[model samples]
Target chain A: MFGRIFHLLVKEFLQMKRDKSARFRLLVPPVIQMLLFGYAATFEVFNVSTAILDLDRSQESRALTDAFVHSSRFRIAVPAASERDVRDAVERSDVQVGIVIPAGFAELLKKGRTSPVQALVDGTNSNTALIALGYVGQIAGSFGQDYARNLAERTGRALGRPMVSVGLEERYWYNPNLNSRWFFVPGVIGTLALITIVNLTAFAIVREREVGTLEQILVTPLRPVEFIIGKTLPFFLIGLLEVSIVAGFGMAWFHVPFRGNPLVLLLGTCLFLLAALAIGLLISTVCTTQQQAFSSNFFVLNPMFILSGFSFPIPSMPQALQWLTYADPLRYYLVIIRATFLKGVGLDALWPQMLALAAIALGLLTVAVLRFRKSLD
Target chain B: MAGAIVEATGLSKRFGAVMAVDGLSFAVQPGEIFGLVGPDGAGKTTTMRMLAGVMRSDDGSITVDGIDVRAHPEQAKRHVSYMPQRFGLYEDLTVEENIRFYADLFEVPRRLWEERAAAMLTASNMTPFRKRLAGQLSGGMKQKLGLTCSLVHTPRVLLLDEPTTGVDPLSRREFWQILYSLRGEGVAMVISTAYLDEAERCDRLALLHDGRMVHCDTPAGLKAKMPGAMIEVAAAEPRRVRDAVQKLPGVAGVLLIGIGAHIHVDDAGRRLPEIAAALSAAGIATTEIGEVAPSIEDLFVALLENERNAA
Candidate 1:
């Protein structure tokens, strides 16, 4: 059995090695995809172009404008003389946000009256625009509060404060800064590895069926268990190599933190890969043609990605869908990976997720091997 | 021999209600090529799959090298190399790589693989293209590469399922040369082929139809058992001649071969005269009529017709 399995592993490895194009397919593309997805796939909007319409042209209005300019979230583009300029700048895509400080003449501050300021924002890309608009509200509100406090102090008037203002202290559990890149980069690594490895193995077996080499392999002294293990070992190693490369890029280039123990990450990655390869093997067992295998893999993979909590948080999904996430190996691995990297948590805190991943890996592999063996029979 | 190298007793398999190999039984000698010759859906592949231990038989038993294949499939597989109709060559891998892969899977020792691989490549004339990927090779080269991969382990028996189906005539001949060479090495071979001419190359041929082994004998012996003499009839319109000849008194079977018709009859000495008269009566010109040796295909058709008529 050992001999048979060793033979298969060696064969798989040689196939990967002999085809330089395949090797490049297995190695380079994942890194490239990691970088592309790392930089391009982000939710946080920065450097949002904002046009300022200074209708007041007064000292107080200029000071308000200066505060908006210094905010990191907004990049002040054009100093608009009229409201039409602000609309033109926004319509032409010169600015994603517009700030309008009405002519107050500094009298509203003197009378302790709340003045309204209109902030126009482009809503074409709604998410980014909404985030930008929120920043505008925050800056204006803080500036008004500070200005009122100063006036009260200068006049020596007693300040009346409401005790019912709720200050909710919320902390991000896994990701402190809410850095989407840290989440997406690891998810991208998992996704890319899953896709490439599963596809390669699926086609690997289907190619055998199509070309008639499968019969040749079947006639050998190799046991079904041996064959399954041998076929998946090389792909398992390839997945590991890919994870390291992507993880390296994530850490060095993207400055994504890797706070978890490397060993645990490697172990989790290996289990995930085994589960992926098993799924590929199972696909191969059912499909006779390469085209069929490819289409079926896509059919399974697309759903796995959506349900895996790679794009959306599993916890935020509906109860039923969230429960389904337990079946998804990616969800567990992604959680463990994120927790380890960003939060720097270990197995002590992540044991349940780690155990779930291990269970999925073992279950998938066992079913795959059994099915393959049954097919041979 | 005391015992056949490979034996199947009442081996049966079914897909739904259609019996693919119904109570099929056969045995191959230790060092002979046993050919299973039949039409496309004659259960040839199903039988081969069962024998190779890649598929389970619904009933009966298969013994390969003294081990029950059904009970000990892996053990049986140790002594056999099965080349399915498709011949699963890894197209992405090179000729040498494919061979090496199979050799390793079969656990051929490192030293033996180097020597056997070199010889197998040379025999298939695939040495020149050893570095080329299997996908890059032509149909003929790919078949040869597939054969080489199967033979890397040097099994006692080789089960080939239509290894030369889509290959060119020249490549087909080359493939047979390799098989014949293996025969010299005392390897028992069970080959299933659609081409009757290829069946003639085997030591013995089994005529299979609807999952049953109708007849098994040497190619010449099977042809000798053909009910009557076969005559090739040439006419301006062969189809008209075929129709007319079929209605004739002694005409047994009429088959279209190329532009002419091969007419089978009970007794060629008396039947030819009757066939010619019938053709003339039907206004179909008979340019040529003479007795010719029956091919394996003619014998197969005759057997299938006999079975159908009996049913």
Candidate 2:
């Protein structure tokens, strides 16, 4: 059995090596995609175009507008003379945000009363809008705190008692700077590995069936289990190699840290590869043609990708969908990989995810093996 | 029957509403080449697939080399090498690589395959092309490579389904030479072919029609059993000759061949002069008219026609 599987692996690799498209697919696309996703699949908002309408022509209003200009997050691309201009800027998407300083005229600050600043936002792309709003809130919040502190210091000198003020201190864990690259680079490893392994595994078998080699092999003395092992083992190794390439590129190019033990990541990868290869094998058994396999890959991988929490947070998904994510190997793999890359956690901390991944992998492999019959039904 | 290497009894396979192979019974002896001759969709492939143990028979049983195919198909597969109509050779791999892969699949030892591969390649005149990728080889060479791959392990029973259907005549003859050599070594072979000329080369032939075996015999026996004599009429337009004589009395059928027509009649001597006279009167010119030995196709058509008339 070992000898047969070894020969099968050799044959598979030879075929892969000789076929130009397969060679290209095995190496080039993952790196290109890693670079693309590293930059494109990001949540960190920066240089958000802003329109400023200062109705209050006072020192305090100008200071607030200056604060927006100074901050790296917002760029004062449009300076509005009136509310209509701000509205037009936001409505036409000329600016992602519009800041209107109402006609309070520094009186509220002098009297120690609260002032309301209206932030007009374009909510078409809700995620960008929400993040931009957060930046706006932070800038306005710091300005308010500075003003309150000045007022407290002046009032305390007159009253002979210090005023108490509340302040919030925010610190992000794992990702010290909350760099989105650190978060997304690890997810890119999982996503790219999944797509590459699944496609290679599925196409490997579908190509055989289409070419009629599968029927020829079945008549040989080679057992079904042996053939299955032979056919899938090379792909399993390819999956591992692909993960390493993508992971290594992520670390070197994006500087995505790998904090966990290497052994733990290897184990997690093996389990993940098992699940992915099984899914591909299952698709191959169901499909009689490569075109069917291609379409089926989309049908299967798209849902798994969405539910894997790679880009979208699983908890934020619909309740049923969140439950559905429990069955996706990518979901558990993403957790384990992200934890390893960013948190530097090992088996003890990620045991639950590791176990879930192992269970899903074994379950899928069992089903795939059972579904893959030596006989043509 | 005692030493029959492959025995299939009352085998039946159904596909939805179609009985692809119904009540098929045959035995193949060692060193014999058995042919399944039929038109398209005649269950020859279905029968071969069943005997190879790659497909399950809905009824009956097949025993290949003392192993019950249904009971232990994997075990039965050990002794059988099935080559489908489209012999699946990995096109990207070279000729020697393809053979080595199959040898490994059949668990043939390295030393044994090294020798076997060399011999098989030489036999097919593919020794020089061993390094050439299978896809780059001609269609005929691809079929030879497929055969070489299938024979790497020296299987006891070889099941080939229309192996030479699309091959050139020269290649087809070379392929038969390979089969005859294998037969010399006592390999029981079951080969299916649509070409009747190829069928004539087999030791025995089973004529399949509508998923049933209507006749089984040697080529000479089958032609000798033909009820009517066949007369060949060499004409400029065989189609017109066929149309002119098709409805004549005592005429069973008229098959149009290249540059001539084979007229199946009750008695060739009696009908020959009459056919010639009728054609001359119909303003059709005939170059020659005489009795000719009936081919497997003639016997097959006559048999089917008899059954149709009886039904």
Candidate maximizing TM-score: 2
Q: What lDDT score belongs to each candidate, Candidate 1 first?
A: 0.83, 0.88
Clashes of each: 6, 0
Stretches > 4 Å off in candidate 2? A16-24, A55-60, A78-88, A101-117, A144-164, B273-282, B309-311
Q: Give the Cα-based TM-score of candidate 1 against the true structure.
A: 0.87
Pairs that collide, model 2 = none
Per-residue lDDT of A180-277 in model 2, one digit per residue for the tens? 88988888888888888898889888888899988888888666677778888887888888889989998999888888888998999999988898
Kindly report which residue stretches of model 1 are placed more than 4 angstroms away from their true locations once superposed: A49-70, A75-111, A118-126, A150-180, B90-101, B108-149, B152-154, B177-186, B247-252, B266-271, B277-285
For model 1 the local lDDT of residue B80 reads 86
Candidate No. with top lDDT: 2
Restricted to chain B, the TM-score per model reads 0.96, 0.98
Residues B1-311 of candidate 1 have per-residue lDDT tens digits of 35689989999998998999999888898789999988878899999989888899999999988899999987788788888767777777777777877777777788998898898788778788878888899888888887887878788889999888889999998998898888998899999987878888899998888898889989888888889889889877888888887877778889988768999899999987888788788888777888999987788888888888998
DockQ for all candidate structures vs. native:
0.64, 0.71
**Candidate 2 CAPRI category:** medium
- Fnat across every predicted model, in order: 0.95, 0.92
